[model samples]
Target chain A: MSAFYSVLKRELRSYFASPLAYIILVVFQVISARFFFLYLQGFLQFQLDPSYQLQTGDLNLNNLVILPYFGTISIVLLLIVPLITMRLIADEKKNYTAELLFTSPIHIRTIVLGKFAAALILLIMMLLLSSVNVFVLMVHGNPDLGAVLSGYTGLFLLGASFLSIGIFASSLTDNQLIAAVISFGVLLVLWLVGALSDAESSILGYLSVINHYEDFGKGIVDLKDVVYYVSLIFLGLFLTYSALESERWR
Target chain B: MVYVHNLTKRYGNLTAVENLSFQLERGDVLGFLGPNGAGKTTTMRIITGYMPPTKGTVHIEGVDIFDEPLQAKRVIGYLPENPPLYNDMTVMEYLSFVADIKKVGRKEKKSRIFYVMERCGIAEVRRRIIGHLSKGYRQRVGIAQALVNNPSVLILDEPTIGLDPRQIIEIRELIKSLSGDRTVILSTHILPEVTMICSKVIIINHGKIVLEESLQKLSEDMRSAESILLRTRQNGEGVVEKIHALGNVSSVKPGAAGEYIIVPRKGAEVREELSRLAVENDWGLLELRPVTNTLEEVFLKVISSEGN
Candidate 1:
């Protein structure tokens, strides 16, 4: 566990030592805050329309505002999380620090887990920052507490799954641009599988990460979706560990 | 307390280290001499447990590197050909990170990092970023990282390969100071480096061990086969003919400008007799000095003959 913490501390320090972390944080804040304001404006405009109000029984602020806000955060993560994770293993190989880590007494799992945790921490921070919208809604109106809690859980799972995939992509190459491209390509395919599939009950939907995230957006927590994301996290980390172990041969 | 037996690493059909085996007792500084692409790095990597060999085993104090890599690695500190340093980190941060991963105790981490930095002569630049530091400082940081853990075995590959002369001397002195209970194995093709600090020398060629001998024994062997130059002012075959006919001289041949290089037979001191003969023949001998073999000659003789 000390070995794991050592790597994690080093990795997090490395992230903040460069300007990448600040740039990522600033960009996430701007995009998520803009989406939050736009969603609230659309919600207020709907309430002002008497025809729409007479047709619908009621308006749930959780569904109208908080739910879509989480949706936008996930999309934003898909685009920028690759940028954060591109340098995880790839930079170590490029800079030759992999030699130092490999020669140490620590296991490869500790190294991978440390990097994964670093990326996850940043993602969590961004998620936490975006949750300011929830505070705003609580001060002004009633939002379902259960739905908000489960929605945050789902977003956390989604972010973790993205990070693992990003880390796996980074392990495949030393070029950060190539790593980013690979992660983006893999993520795009997974996200679009929701539209590419023919039926809701098909395997494509089961495989699409964005499809599993839809339940949490609606404040509905399902066991299958949680299992899917957890399995993906395991699979991605397993592949990364295997890739690092086999790189010594080449 | 290090042993390697028949260690072989093959990348596809090409072999990097082929059946290489050697041993190092505690406090023995071994000079690993080899030409380029001769598998010095590959062998060191295998011994450090950074990578496994294709076949064979390495034992660090009786613990197999492949079977129990963590325990084995804890006792061995390796500095690869290129120092593995993070450019973004300060020297202090990098060393502390290494000390942490090397499992230096919580209380001793600060003192250990400071000690290695001081020992490696990088204390002045502890807060400087590694990327901005010059090559010499970077190399020192690499050595400092290896020393932070206080490992029993040290493997340094070309530790002074690119340093200026003063830096090289400082590093060599540092390495010499490090050779008490800790066994040090450093690789270099430079013969003087081997002669200066190494108690024993292992010359390698074509990914195979060619010669492994103690410095004492090697120096003794160098004294047996000797050559001397005899330059005379009077130019004639008389000088060569008379020197060749002498009993102690093995062979005498004409050299440029009335000079002849005479090879004395093994264990023969023909310098005085040659001088007497030169006076009798009226051959004014200008230069007659023993050309003792340097480490260059010994290294050349070892590699050139064994290359086949």
Candidate 2:
């Protein structure tokens, strides 16, 4: 466990030592803030009463108020998580530092998990910063804490899954750009799978990330959705570990 | 002690190392001599448990490296051909991280980092970011990370590659000073370094051990057939013929400036006889010095023979 933490700390330090973490945070915050103000302007122009409670309008005023915020947060995270993870293993391999980690007494799983944990911590920090938009919504009107917490929960899981996928992709090559491109491509496919599938082809829909995320966005915590996201994270992380292990043989 | 038995590593159809086997005793500095792409790095990687051999076994302190890699790896420290460094990190941070990965106790980690830094002469650069340091200091930090855990065996692959002459000497001296207490296996194409620091030299060629012998025995067994440079005032006068007639002298040829080079049969030293011949001929002998074979020559001979 200490070994895991040490690797985690080293990875976090690496992130902060470069311009990457700060860049990702600033870009994400700026985009989320922009999206929030745009949504606020639309809300004000529509003259939606702050006291207008939605029992079920065509667009629930409450959903209108929070859904764009969730959308903005998700889009920003989808782009940023890959950037954070693109260099995790690819740069290490390029620098030949993977040999140091592999030869050490630490297990391969710990090294992969540690790097993922570090990236997850950073993603969570960004998610928290994005939540300031939610707090802004709260000041203007009543925002459902339960719905917001569920939304944040979904964002965390989605970011973690993207991070694991990025790590797996990074493990495949020494070129960070290739890793980023491949990770983004994979995430995009997973995100759009549901949109491409109909209810008759719902099995494939389960593979879509948005299918699971929708439940969280709608303030519903389904055990199956949690299991799916957890499995996705594990699957990506497992592939990454296996990829790293095979490098020695190569 | 370390033992390797018929260690072979193959990538698909390409064999990087083939049927290689050698042993090292405690406190022995074994120099791995080979040209580029001669499997020196592959062998070291396998021995250090960074990679498993496709067809053989490596035992570090009797623990099979592939079977119990954690335990086996705990006994060995490896510095790959390129020093594995996180460039963003400071020397102290890198060493501390290595210590953590190597499972050094927290209480002892600081002291271990300090000790290795002092040993590698990078104590003053501990706070500098590794990327900002000079190549020599970066190499020292690499060595420091390898030595942080104080493992029983140290495996360094091209530890002095790319360093300036002064840095090379410093690293060589540091490696030499590490000899008495731990087993060290260093690989290099620099033959003179082997002669200088290694008690035993294992010359590899084309992924095979061409020569594995103690430095003393290798030099003794491959000693140049005795040859002496003889400078005398008496120009010719059949001096070459007269020297060749001596029992131990096999041949003699005229050299530059009224000098003759006398060659003796194997294990024969004809300097004394040649001196007597020159003195009896009333020739003023200017010089009589034996020509010895250097490690470079021996290395070339061994490697060239393998090429054939």
Per-prediction TM-score, chain B alone: 0.92, 0.93
lDDT by residue (tens digit), candidate 1, A1-250: 2989878888899889999998999899999999999999998898888876575534668778888888888999899989989999999999878888998989999999999998888888888888887888999998888888989999899889988999999999999999999999998998998788779889887799988988887778999999999999999999999999998866
Name the weakest run of 10 consecutive residues (lDDT summed) in model 2 chain B.
Answer: B218-227
Give the residue spans of candidate 1 off by over 4 A: A55-58, B234-237, B241-246, B272-285, B301-307
Best-fitting candidate, scored by DockQ: 2
The native-contact fraction of candidate 2 is: 0.88
- What DockQ does model 2 achieve? 0.77
What are the per-residue Cα lDDT tens digits for candidate 1 across B1-308? 89999999999999988999999999999999877887888899999988889999999988898899889889888899899999999999999899888888889899989999989999999999999999999999999999999989999999998899999999999999999998899998778988899999888777789888998888877877678888888577667778878887888878888688889999999999988988888787788888778888877787899865
Candidate 2: segments with Cα more than 4 A from true spot: A48-61, B233-235, B255-257, B265-268, B279-284
Candidate 2 local lDDT, A74-172, one digit each (tens): 877777777998999999989999889889988999999999999999998898888887787778687678888898899899889999999999999
Interface Cα RMSD for all candidates? 1.5, 1.5
